[model samples]
Target chain A: GIQVEQSPPDLILQEGANSTLRCNFSDSVNNLQWFHQNPWGQLINLFYIPSGTKQNGRLSATTVATERYSLLYISSSQTTDSGVYFCAVASVYGGATNKLIFGTGTLLAVQP
Target chain B: EAGVTQFPSHSVIEKGQTVTLRCDPISGHDNLYWYRRVMGKEIKFLLHFVKESKQDESGMPNNRFLAERTGGTYSTLKVQPAELEDSGVYFCASSQDRVGYSYEQYFGPGTRLTVT
Candidate 1:
C-alpha cells in the first residue's frame, strides 16, 4: 500500500489571506483528490487532480505525478474554510475500483 | 442531479448489536465505494463496488462487517455484533465510471456510527 503524507499539520490564516498545503505520496498513484471537511463534518471534494493543474473559484491544485506530490492552494481564504483539509490518493496497484488512501490531513483555521 | 446519499446521518448502538448503513449513488454512476474514518485518524477504504458486483473488498476489516450491492443501484453495509472500535464515520462515494481512466469519486456527507 502507498502512504500519503500531508504537511503543515495545522494552519491559521486571516480572512482574505492565502495558504498552500502539500501532499507527498510514497509511490505513483492513479487518483488524487483534495477535500475540505467543514464544521458540519461534510467532506467536500475540492479537487480531483491526478496530474496537471486545476482551479475552481479561489481554490487551485496541481499534481506533478513524476514528483509524487500534489499542492493545494486556497486564495482569499474565508472563515468557512476553517476545518480539516485532507489529501487522498488511490494506488495504481489497487485496480480499477479507485479505493482511496488518505493522509493525516491539515487542520486549517481561518480567523475573521 | 443527486450526489451520493447515505442514510442515518448518525447512529449510536450498544456493543453486540447489529446496524446497517445504506448508500445510494448518483444515477448512472457505475463505481461505488465505502470508507471509514476512526476518531483522530485518517479515512480508510473499506470496499468498492462496480455495479452489482463487489469489485474489491480488500480493505474490509473483518467478517463482522458485511457489504452488499444489489441490482447495481443502492448498497448496504451491515455490522453485526458491533464492537466499540466500530465507532467512526462511514463515507460513501460514487463515480461516473468503474474503471478505465475516470477516477473522480463524489463522496456523500457520511454516516457517523458510535458503538457504545
Candidate 2:
C-alpha cells in the first residue's frame, strides 16, 4: 500500500491571495490527482498529473514523480475556492484498476 | 458531458436495516469505483468495477457490503443489516481506460448515510 501525505493541513487565505499546497507520496505512482471537495462535499477533479505540469484556469499542478511529490498552486483565489483539497495516488500494480488512496486533505478557507 | 451521478443524496435508516446506494457513471466509461469516508477519516476505497466485472475488491471492509454493476451502465452498493459503523459518505467515481495507466476519476457529489 502507498502512503500519501498532504502538507499545510489547514490554510486560510484572503481573496486574490496565492497559495501552494504540497502532496508527498511514499512510493512511485501511476495515477496522481488533485481534487477539491467543495462546500457541498462535491469532489471536483482539479488535475490529473502523474508527471510534468498542467494549468487549468486559476489552478495549476506540477508532479515530480521521481521525487514522489506534487504541488498544487492556486492564484488569485476566490471565496468559492474554500474547501478541502485532497491528493490521491494509485500504484502501477493496480494497472487499470480504480482504487485511489487519498491523503488527509488540506482544508483551505478563502475569506472573501 | 455529464459527470458521475449518485442517487438518494442522503439516507437515514435504523440499525440492521438494508440500504442501497446507486451510481450512474458517464456514458461510455468502462471503469467505476466505490469509496467511503467515515467521520473524521479520509476517503477509503471500497471496490472497483470494470464494466460489470469486479476488478479489485480488496478494500471492501466485510461481506455485508455487496456491490453490483448490472449491464455495465449503472452500479449499486447494498449494505445488508447496516450497522452504526456503516454510517458515512459513500462516493462513486468513474474513469476511462488509458493505454498504460488509468485516467483521472470523476467523482459524484456522494451519498451521506446515517444509521441509528
Candidate 3:
C-alpha cells in the first residue's frame, strides 16, 4: 500500500492571501489529482496533474512526479475557498483500476 | 452537462440494519467509484466500476458491503447488518475514461450514513 502525507495539517489565511499546500507520496504514481471538499462536502476536482503544471482560475497545481510530491497553490484566496484539500494518487502497479489513495487532507480556513 | 448525483443525502440506522446508497454518474462517463470518509479520517476507496463491470473492488472492507452497477448507468452500495464502525460519509465519483489522459473525477455531495 502507498502512503500519502499532506503538510500543515491545518492552515489559516486571510482573504486575498496566497498559500501553498503540499502532498508527498511514498512511491511513484501514474495518476495524481487535487480535490477541494467544499463546505457542503462536495469534493470538487481542482486539478489532475501526474506531472508538470496546470492552472485553473485562482487555483493551480504542480506535481514533480520524480520527486514524489505535489504542490497546490491558491492565489488571492477567498472565504469560499475555505475547506479541506486532498491529494489522491493512483499507483502505477494498480494502473487504471480507478482506486485512489487519498492523503489525510489539508484543512484550509480563509477568514474574511 | 450533469454531474454525479447521490440520493438520500443522509441516513441513520441502527446496528444490524441494512441500507442502500445510490449514485448516478454523469451521462457519458464510463467509470464510477465509491469512497468513504469515516469520522476524522481521510477518504478511503471502496470500489470501482467500469460500466456494469466491477473493475476493482480491492478496497472493499468486508463481505457485509456489496456494490452494484446496473446497466452501466447508476450504481448502488448496500451495507447489510451495518455495524457501528460503518458510519461515515460515502462519496460517489465518476470519470470520463479508464486509461490514458488523467480525467477529473466529478464527485457527489455525499451520503452521510450514521449507524447507531
Candidate 2, Cα interface RMSD: 1.2
**lDDT winner, 1 or 2:** 1
Give a tens-digit lDDT track for model 1, residues A2-112.
999999999999999999999999888988999999877789999999999999999999999999999999999999889999999998987767788999999999999
lDDT of the candidates, in the order given: 0.93, 0.92, 0.92
Residues A34-111, model 2: lDDT tens digits: 999887777888999999999999999999999999999999999999999999999877665747999999999999
Off by over 4 Å in 2: A95-98, B98-102
Each candidate's interface RMSD: 0.8, 1.2, 1.5
Give lDDT tens digits, candidate 3, residues A13-60.
999999999999988887799999988777888888989999999999
Docking class of 1: high
On the 0 to 100 scale, the lDDT of residue B48 in model 2 is: 95
RMSD of candidate 3 to the truth, in angstroms, is 1.6
TM-score: model 3 vs. ground truth? 0.93
Candidate numbers, best lDDT first, in rank order:
1, 2, 3
Query: In candidate 2, which residue pairs get closer than 3 Å at backbone N, Cα or C atoms, i.e. clash?
Result: none
Q: Note the DockQ of each predicted structure.
A: 0.88, 0.77, 0.73
Best by DockQ: 1
DockQ-based class of model 2: medium
Which structure among the candidates has the greatest TM-score? 1
